[model samples]
Target chain A: MHYTRDNMAGLLRSHDINPTHQRIEIAHALFSRQEHLSADQVMAIVNTRHSETSKATVYNTLKLFLEKGLVREVIVDPSKVFFDPNTSPHHHLYEVDSGKLSDIDAEHVVISGLPPLPAGMVTEGIDLIVRVRRTS
Target chain B: MHYTRDNMAGLLRSHDINPTHQRIEIAHALFSRQEHLSADQVMAIVNTRHSETSKATVYNTLKLFLEKGLVREVIVDPSKVFFDPNTSPHHHLYEVDSGKLSDIDAEHVVISGLPPLPAGMVTEGIDLIVRVRRTS
Candidate 1:
């Protein structure tokens, strides 16, 4: 589906999110490119479109997106967290030095020995991160 | 091996750490417990032993330990980063609600289909986190 501003309102509504004008713009910033973006990156994109977004707005919007299951938070590096637009099952490949992150197809990877969850608990999700660095 | 303050000096020196009194106290707090500890927890534990340590001292000493390969940083929760005493190869099981973390034996787990390194890049490490929540 095309992730333009027009579709953002409906998408947000479907996700049970209040599609305010600012939220739509922030959602468009993340969904349009379908890339992993940090809060700063999202702000940078949204700011180009309009000047109404404050840092707190962008942060709150992102947190709302996370809570509504609209985006996944990727924390490969502690300092630089990324919000992944694609929520499909997948792993991550992180370039440590460059701080670049990309998806690794889950179908191509095999992770075994996942223990049964403790009684009264359910599995939320699994995150596998492969961190790499350039030969120095 | 017992992790006591007396041994921390030698351990620090072996890892090329300076083994200052504060460093040894901090190291002993982490290694002696052999559990994942947040910076605050480390501070709390060290504060009881002595009153000379500051917040900056605790943070810098932990950074030094991490750089010197004496500890591992676990970022399960964004706000509460943990310092792991055990450096052995292992994964993590994170309790979403209780904020409890435990080691998962990497040997029992089989992770296959690790792609070859990119040209001139090398693999730093892989982290696998199993997140679970209480059935509520």
Candidate 2:
């Protein structure tokens, strides 16, 4: 599937976002790469060609995308957070030392036997993260 | 099962962490309550009576505790990170609306059908978080 800037704008509109120039660029960066990225990384990519986007704009735009349900946030650890483009049901595999992350299809994973939720509570989403290390 | 400051010292020693006064207080704040706490919450608790602990100290101490396996870090989402005192095998249930978090014993849950890891990679840890919301 081709992810053009035009397509990014369309995606943003469908998700009820304003599709500003910077927003479209940020969305294109994420959707086109289809990889997990931190806010710092997102800013770097958007400003690689021209130093136009500020750090605050990158952060604000990412937060906006999150609020609009256009991306998923993956917290690899306390200090690391990545924005994921694919919002479909899935899990994550993180390379500990390398800081690499990839998606794990939810269909192949089976998680069961969890205790029932507390009274009046309903499930919103389940996040499964498997951290791995390179064998010596 | 008693988690007193004295025991906190011993626990720190066993884990090879230096039991400084602030470190012990931080440990007590986490272990005594056996609850998930953020650095900000930790600092607040450690200084609830006496304003002694600095934000940097609390953050560094928590990092030390994590490196020494004295605690587990729970990332409920992008903006929320909690330090869990219970390090035994377990999962987590997070309240999306109220931001309450609880532990799920790993013994009762069964996870299967994950795809094989890429060659040369070994599993370090698996985190399963079930996000629940209060029924409206």
Candidate 3:
């Protein structure tokens, strides 16, 4: 379901963040946009409708979102970072030509199995980013 | 196998990289170490033994290693980049407490079938990284 205003409010409450108008708008932009975005890109979009939202605010809000586990950061390119709003376990195909990112559902690739962690080490979560180049 | 001089030479040759003495030594230091390292860390080790190896060489060699697909770069932590000598297709678990990384073989986690890529997009390799935090 689309992230309604109520949903954004609930998310802010759960994360202990104030559901300010700017925060809600930012969240709505992220949740509504299907494509991955960089912080600068998010800021650009937020500024289009709301001129009061500062770049620093956008960065801080994104950090808060990441801390609350509401967003995922993709590092397909070593130089730049992309943020994905979808929190579900999934992989990505990074288009080398366009620098566009698309999510791949977790159900698709057959993960053979992961080797056990070393002694005294604990397992956490997994990130799979598939980088794609144009073959044709 | 222990990454001896000969072993390093063989690895370089296998990857079509010219096995310079410096490259072999850097390879030895990288493969022999148990910890994941940044280019600076590799430089530290190489300079300790050979005063002639400059930072430029370390960066260049690391780039060569990465280009040849002999090493993997871990992006779990944004502060510093870590390089993995293990080139096998596997995931990683980042220890949030210690910032240590360990390889997870591809067999443990089952990555099933993947969703189709968007129209005009092609599938590429996948990157899986698991971050873990201790409850205590």
State chain A's TM-score for model 3: 0.87
lDDT over C-alpha atoms for residue B78 of model 2:
61
Share of reference contacts kept by candidate 3: 0.72
Compared with the true structure, what per-residue lDDT tens digits does model 3 show for residues A102-124?
Answer: 88777656666566555665555
Q: Model 2: residues >4 Å from true position, as ranges?
A: none
Error of 1 at B120 (Å): 1.6
| Per-residue lDDT of candidate 2, residues B1-136 (tens digit) | 7988899899999999989999999999999898999888999988988799898998898988999999998877667679999999999999988888999999979999999999999999999999999999
Candidates, DockQ: 0.76, 0.72, 0.48
Q: Provide the lowest-lDDT 10-residue window in model 3 chain B.
A: B116-125
lDDT of 3 by residue, B38-116 (tens): 8888888888854968888998888889888988777777666788888777777888898778777775577667666
Scored by Cα lDDT, where does model 1 land?
Answer: 0.89
Task: TM-score winner between 2 and 3, please give it.
Answer: 2
Q: After superposition, how far is residue A97 of candidate 3 from its true place, in Å?
A: 3.5
Instruction: State the TM-score of candidate 3 restricted to chain B.
Output: 0.88
* Predicted complex 2: CAPRI docking category: medium
Model 1 regions lying over 4 Å from their true place: none
Supply the global lDDT for candidate 3: 0.79
Q: Supply the TM-score for candidate 3.
A: 0.80
Ranking by TM-score: 1, 2, 3
Q: Which residue pairs in candidate 1 have backbone atoms (N, alpha carbon, C) closer than 3 angstroms, thus clashing?
A: none
